[model samples]
Target: MSSRNLPDDKKLIDLQRFQLLVNAITDYAIYMLDTDGRVVSWNAGAQKFKGYTSEEIIGQHFSQFLTPEDQKAGIPALALQTAETEGRYETEGWRVRKDGSYFWANVIIDAIRENGRLLGFAKITRDITDRRKAEEALRLSEQQFRLLVQGVTDYAIYMLDKEGNVSNWNAGAQRIKGYRQEEVVGTHFSRFYTDEDQQDGVPQRALLTARTEGRFEQEGWRVRNDGSKFRAHVVIDPIYNAINEFVGYAKVTRDITEKYKAAIALKQTEQALQQAQKMETIGKLTGGIAHDFNNLLQIISGNLQLLSAEIAGNQRAEKRVTNALAGVRRGAKLASYLLSFGRRQALDPKVVNIGRFVLEMEDMLQRSLGETIEVETILADDLWNTFVDVAQVENALLNLAVNARDAMDSVGKLTIEISNAVLDENYARAHVEVNAGEYVMLAVSDVGSGMPSEVVAQAFEPFFSTKPEGKGTGLGLSMVYGFVKQSGGHANIYSEPGYGTTVKLYFPRSTELENCVVIQTVENIVGGTETILVAEDDEQVRHTAIEMLTALGYKVLHADDAQSALAIIEAGVKIDLLFTDVVMPGPLRSPELARKARELLPDLAVLFTSGYTQNAIVHGGRLDAGVELLGKPYSREALARKIRSVITNSIQR
Candidate 1:
């Protein structure tokens, strides 16, 4: 129905119903204000919100509900003027209640005009303090979190978008990746990976794994902005929103280059220690076997020599005995090589300038290598002195030269370099068996077919040879290794396929003056007429020794062990010399027997013989001071010379 046709009473009832609806709202203060901003009408909601009764607040200016600052700024009047002219006004600010308390409020004003004439205005206000406080707290928490992430410097923490592009970077990310935040943001995260890694889709796989499995962690090489690479430990976690939807990834990376290198060095050292232990075990077994074999060779050699004397003038018999003797000598030489590899042979060390010694042997080395091999010696001007067995050094050099010649297929340059070297702690740490110290380095290099890593690993092992069977005994390198180690030195070999090979021996430097003593050769095997006491554990060795000495015109005495020999010495027997084996079964050791026998016979001469000294009369691979020693498996001539030499030296002393 049209408003003009409706009854006045019905219109009044409709207006009253609208008032009741507006008054029922308890959350919003609903009221009316005159054009001048005076409170002309108030509702129940206004009384509840402002803590005021209708009688107390009626006719009061609406400005009374505004804060003092807002009232002074004339905001209430402006609000009313805006509503009258523009029809409506809305704002949010602090408003005061009747009790003088302020609350954050949302306010609105609407003009109620009749026929374009000035009229009152309707106003509404809502308390919004709790919501404002919550929003403020959230903003503060986000700021603090951003600052925390930016302050870290040890780890690269960053955020990636859903498509793996960098969204945000922290200070740690800038420091570790060598890039500024402006340079990294909006770029693909794959740029931080190596080209190989990127080609393998490692970055994408990491993101996918994190998205599917919740997290991904790995260690690998990472490229920085400057293009340098480092070992990195990385972790990726899929970021999720409050509703559990995947947004992106949170990546963290740490540089672990030094730690990774240290781990690798430790592993290499462990492998070296294991190899050394294996070699040591093998040395012990070979040493024992060689010792026993030497004893048998000695007996056989002695019997053959005696047989040769019996078959004098008989060419056939003499030739047969001579061939047998040659066999025994070869067996003895084989046993000696084993002892050398085992580091069981006694050494006669002398201080020598290695450069001069090598120069003197240049002619011999040249002749040994043949015309096909070019020999070159690079000796340092002021090379250091080392205490070592001169004969053994010569042998070691010859062995290395021959090996180099063979490696070069008999047609390449062989270089021998001698120089002073100092090994530092870092080298010692990487090589477990090496000691950090000054050393005289002897390096031999060859331009030949190099060895692979597997072959180089077992190069020093006895019987491990690359040469065809029967072409090599395989003890050349092993003997050199043992001799260097026994002389308190280190041996190392470097080789690569198709390149070349170099073997370096580092001998401890010595401060002693060089000794150039010339050893006189005994051309004639002369016998002596003196009482000689032979003490040996093996029955055959003892009997053979007694017969040989008796044949040499000496009154020979025999004893099964050191104790028996000592008893005979204590019985006041006038003995010119004591020939005793170093290793015996009796409680009275050979060394002790020698000491006691010398005490009883003040002018007695002593000679020690051993297939194995077993550290009894040898210390640090050298014979004890003032002790005379003769190695086992000696020929008749050698036995005669050594016996006579000892007796004459003892009588002279």
Candidate 2:
């Protein structure tokens, strides 16, 4: 410790060199302490590291450099005890410097003894602040990661033993599996599987696969504690020790019920879109056929009307004419049904007072549903009026009544309620194609045997039926769905097994317009003559139309194609009406021809005819809102009447 204590000569030179080497090291505080614990020597390294000069700290007590807590805990005494008994002591502690700052230090004290007596202690202290900080940071980061994993409520994060036993569970696992940690830990992971899955040994296979292949991934039904099944995406990973020996497994399970539902919904939507496209195509085809057939019907009806007028009081002929008129009406109904399927059902939207509508349906519901079921109406007064096709809405209500009657087996209470609704952003976000606005809510509730969850899910899927074979067509709700959707509304169904079912239809509120009114045309109208242009692709129908028009006394010019018809018009043919089929060849159609012909002859009355009405030309069997058009399969009388009407309407316009 002192210069006088140094031995003389070359071996002492080696010791001096070693001391010089230690003093040059700034990372460690290499110094000497006296037998009584006083700091005897401080090297250049100690001075630089401990913020002290030899003059200031040489005679100070070594405990003075330790933190107060360490000193209070007798850490200095323990160091001295180790130096005495084991000849050295090593430890890490917070040690102070001359500047009153502290750092994490690794300290080693070695007892220096000679000739069976203790002279002093050699001490070495290294700054370990960076290592300590790094360890602390790593520990904190791990804690945060654990918290993040536990906080996930959408996924079940847990661990399993190598034998597929549950070893750990997080909050997320508890929330998803409906189990507390105490109820699930140490149990076999197979408990999460459905009965069928468990019987199939799926859980064992999953673990086996994970152990053999290092990982296993699957998606299927997983049971909850309450016995309900959820669609889940699961992954199991084999955890191994450093020697690659399997220790346990890490299993992550996510309840993908919403995601699965969304996927199914998307698939259904695609199918619906494809079906819609197909229906549109069919509509166009049927419409073309109907258009031609209609011209033929016009010819027949016109001649029959003329004959009926001329042969008045001939009972046999009169009876035949009445039968024909009745047949034509039935045919019109079939065409309308087809149009509804094509979403071309004519929509005559009006601002409807929903309360009044529901009230109006109650008597009909009572009569249709019978006395066994009580019909209740909860009509909210002054509810926002909705722009809707009232006749379609009434039909939809009747359809719902029939559905409820079937569900309830005709013996439960049916509630039809109308109320003002405010559809906010949340509702709009949850239901596609819905917007935030005021709506008129027409809710139908039934206390019945109720539908299964799956049935409720597909309640509005077209052609999806649960009724016994030959009992139902499954188009009732689909039509309701289409009608409501086309009217700018939303529909929702809620049902649970053995409870009841509630269906809500929301139609956007109309700011103006009022009560639905059916437009009336002349009933039992007779035939008339008008110069007409008949454009038809079918030869039989074209020839029939020409004969019918000529017989009816209309100077007729005929063309089989829209192009030829246009050429006739271009050549200054004085056609009073442009009568054409809706679907035509080339780039022109009945509607397009009418536009061109009307330009050529401004006073020309245009009439469109189609077998099965469609969106492009007709809506719900009526002409598109403002278009004066006629549907196909018309009788001779209807044809003549429609021509007269169109011509008369043209005059009025």
The model with the greatest lDDT is 1
Window of ten residues with lowest summed lDDT in model 2: 613-622
Model 1: per-residue Cα lDDT over 1-653, one tens digit each: 97666899988888899989988888888988887787877788788868888788878888888888888898987898788889999998888888889888889999997778878888998888898778778888889988988999999999999999999999999999999999989999999999999999999899999999999999999999889999999999999999998899999999998999899888988887886687677668767776678789889989988888888999999888889888888777667777777788788788999889998998999998999899899998788899988888998999999999999999999999999999999898777678999999999999999999999999998889999988988988988988898898999999998888999999999988898755444569777789999999898988888889999899998899999999999898889999999998969998899888888899999999987777898799877877888888988898998888788778778
Cα-based lDDT at residue 107, candidate 2: 91
| Per-candidate TM-score against the hidden true structure | 0.83, 0.56
lDDT of 1 at 111: 96
Off by over 4 Å in 2: 1-338, 344-378, 401-415, 444-449, 468-471, 496-502, 515-520, 529-533, 542-559, 563-578, 586-588, 599-604, 612-625, 635-648
Task: Give each prediction's root-mean-square deviation over alpha carbons.
Answer: 4.2, 10.0
- lDDT (CA) per prediction: 0.88, 0.79
On residues 1-653, what C-alpha lDDT tens digit does candidate 2 reach at each position?
A: 76556667866897889878987888778899998788988888788778988889888889988999888998888898889789999988788988899889999999998876999899998889999999989999989989998888888999888777788889989999999999999999898998899889898899889988988999999999998989999999989889988799999999998899789768766765876687678557555555555556655655565567677998998999878867666555544544555565657666778788778778887998899988988988678778776788888899888899888988989898889999998666455457899988998999887788888878776668888887877778877876787677888898887888899999988888675544445566454566788898877667767776677688888888899999999998687888887766677766778888888898888887655444566544344555765556665666777888778777766
Scored by lDDT, model 1 comes in at 0.88
lDDT of 2 at 567: 98
